[model samples]
Target: MPDASRITPPVVAPTEAPVNPVSMHIRLDPGMPLAHLESVYHAVNTEKNAQGIYQLTLQDAQVPANRDFELLWVPAPGNAPQAALFNEQWQGDEYALLMLMPPAPAPAGATARRVPREVIYVIDTSGSMHGDSIIQARAALKLALERLTTADRFNVIQFNHQTSALFSRAVAATADNLQRALSYVDRLVADGGTEMLPALQLALGQQPEQGVLRQIIFLTDGSVGNEQALFSLIHQQLGDSRLFTVGIGSAPNSFFMTRAAQFGRGTFTYIGKVAEVGEKMAALFSKLETPRLTDIEIHWPQDQPVEMWPARIPDLYLGEPVLVALKLQQPNLPLTLTGDAAGVPWQQQVTLRGGAARSGVHQLWARRKIADLMDQRAQGVAEPEVRKAVLDVALTHRLVSRYTSLVAVDKTPSRPADQGLENKALPTNLPQGWSATKVFGSLPQTATASEWNLLVGLLLLACGVLFSRWPGVGFGVRVGPVSDGKAHGGNVL
Candidate 1:
């Protein structure tokens, strides 16, 4: 196993003040009329896990008190759609709005019979889910299993380095099956690397069950990186299937869960603690039971070409507000919303004029637009086009996108020209309670570069290949400690 101890650098005394300082040369355009500059500094961020909910055992009945806080939610119009407008610094009029769809009464006889659903519950059993995370996951899955009705067929899938299912396929939600699933979930102990692609493939690669609504519920902290591949898979294989995300653990990746749900045309629910699992899962299931407005469309004033995101509107669920970002030439124009709920046509009109004038709406629009471009790039869009478009919006709005970053550039140098810059990388300690096995397949980014005096015991065999055109072909290096008051040396072949 790799060394787990933290390595600290030699402490510098307060009296010593003779060292080489480092600086950068930032070139500025001569044509600029005005430019501002400041010193660049980065404050290190440290995260302390104070949830006090780790290593919880099944027998531990003592639940930790949840830290509560008051929330201030400005309610929007319940009867009509609402909008928030912001005029961007650039040319276009940017705005963001919540396309709230009041529950449309289903058509007569349309809701007489409930549709059977094929629910596939997937839980991540990776090493990151080892403490309270896994416990919360188990609790969420248990509650979800209890909510299954007799008309629904369900299966439980758990994944780490490998994927396993309670049943080979979806089975009827009978008492026997539910009991078996509950047992399987209870026995799950998080202890392996996260290989999420295989699990996603197994869950979504199959054909949807006939005459049943297919829904995939993922309960995980979403620590698996490389979300681009997963998003692409969900986009390609999602055929008439909805995917709901249940974020487990305190530090669950909200971006990943939310985006996965967006691509799967589903909703995202978060369970921060074990105590909140039942209520959150119950709310999610309640939304699933309500009517979903599908085939949503927006009608903007025809005075200018309007850019709206997501380019394709998603289905609306109960009490879930659809946040829409728009770019238009006019701000106060009326826009119409159209959709169908259980074969019943739904329509509402709202103008952005009387809506609250909120700040940062333009930033929201830019961020969503950038995300839309990135989604396209993931779906095989041209790299240059996407980069150029994203860079333009990101720079004009001064927002950080995947392509653009804000770097503080000083007009003057911090050190003398003759002083050579020496950069020393500091070692980063391993995260508390984390295993070195977490980095088995990848290089450790926290490892620092330090001086190593290798003692190559007398050269047993020497071979060297001098490069002509290609320099990194091969090389022979030999060095040893000094002997007899003389330094031992060898060729850098």
Candidate 2:
């Protein structure tokens, strides 16, 4: 795992202090189906014996270079569609979970140790995070400071209905500076309703010119009322800096935390237990140090009929593997690829000629891409015409798709009108779970030449019978059986 300090170079003199790097946040939604979840996380294990409402399980993964981070999420009974958004960071060997469903209590073994970084601990001392919440918040910040080095620069921010900065901008991490910051944190007693928007705006506006990575570690229970307003602002300003969010208590709303990080391109975590702060910090520091692949873009030829999920991929974190699904028109074709690797441009070509006969792999890839397309559609960014085109192809191939399905219909008619004969009546099927809604017309009947011949023969037989019954025609009657002794009963012809 790369230490967070790795991103920042040390300053040689007093005037050359570096800017602290900020964390990024990513949000997740609950309505994610099992297939969608698998696409996000590399590992998903079905418990062999554990039977319950929540059937999926996730195991913690070590951060590996060149791979994406994996996060496992299991739904609670009756969980809503947009329950939570999770953020995670991968160190080389260990993955740091930033958020999850109901935001599970931080691991008992979890801890946050601040790594050497020019740092700023932005605490929301607003009245919203008061009492026990305030106390825990203070402890979390203290724990964070314990990991800093004197080489780092730091400051604090406390916001309520009003906002205040401990120092105008970044402060050196000298003993006096640390003392002043600690004093400010200790003196923080939460009061007043949360007015977080201006505080964040001010915190970000204080960016220093120091070459070090600039960061703002936001501490809050995320209870501010104006979440939408704050989200809009975060979305607007995130590109300027990195922001990490720490949700202080059990009820802390982690949604805002996750959104803030995502917009700011940083990490989001819920700190339910103060004791575990140090370890979590350690994991985070390692991630900050590593840069597996920057500006990753995966591409393939246009004619391959291959669809890649997550058309817009995010940064690859420690330990998480990047999984790409390819739908190939022909299996043996060689595919050209190009992308940036850690700031350097590179290109490679790969052949998909190997044993693709493995059961279910292709199906899995198809399902994943389809799901991704659905997600894009839901976001309202997908082009309807293009999507419809893709859907048609999926239907023709009978591939699993979000919008198309193989539907069964029954065509048995209950009455003469329903027989779907003349009068332009259309045929209607009795779908298992559905009722007929329209009576547009009748069924179309097409007969073969042989069937027509049979119909003509029957018509001729009927005509002959009617002609024989005409008044001028002779009739014969036999009253007795042919073998009868009387043989009598004339046959009058």
Q: How do the residues 214-318 of candidate 2 rate in per-residue lDDT, one tens digit apiece?
A: 667888877555665666666565544567787775356665687576556567765544454666555554455443444555555666564554454444433
Off by over 4 Å in 1: 1-96, 101-113, 301-303, 409-493
| Candidate 1 lDDT by residue in tens digits, 1-493 | 0221122222222234423332222222211111222221211222223441112121223322211111212233243333333334335554654445444334566643357989899999987687777888898889889988899999888998899888889899999999999998889998866778888888896665678889999998787667888898998888888999987765566888999998988988866667777776877886776646668888975766788888888777655657788777776677888887656787777776656455676888889988888888568788899999999989978898887777887889898999999997543333222334443224334322221212232222222212433564644454567467444774443
Candidate 2 at 35: error in angstroms? Answer: 23
> Candidate 1 — worst ten consecutive residues by lDDT sum?
63-72
Ten residues in sequence with the least summed lDDT for candidate 2: 432-441
The numbered model that scores best in TM-score is 1
Off by over 4 Å in 2: 1-118, 302-312, 319-493
Alpha carbon deviation, residue 149, candidate 2 (Å): 3.3
Return the TM-score for each candidate structure. 0.68, 0.47
Best by lDDT: 1
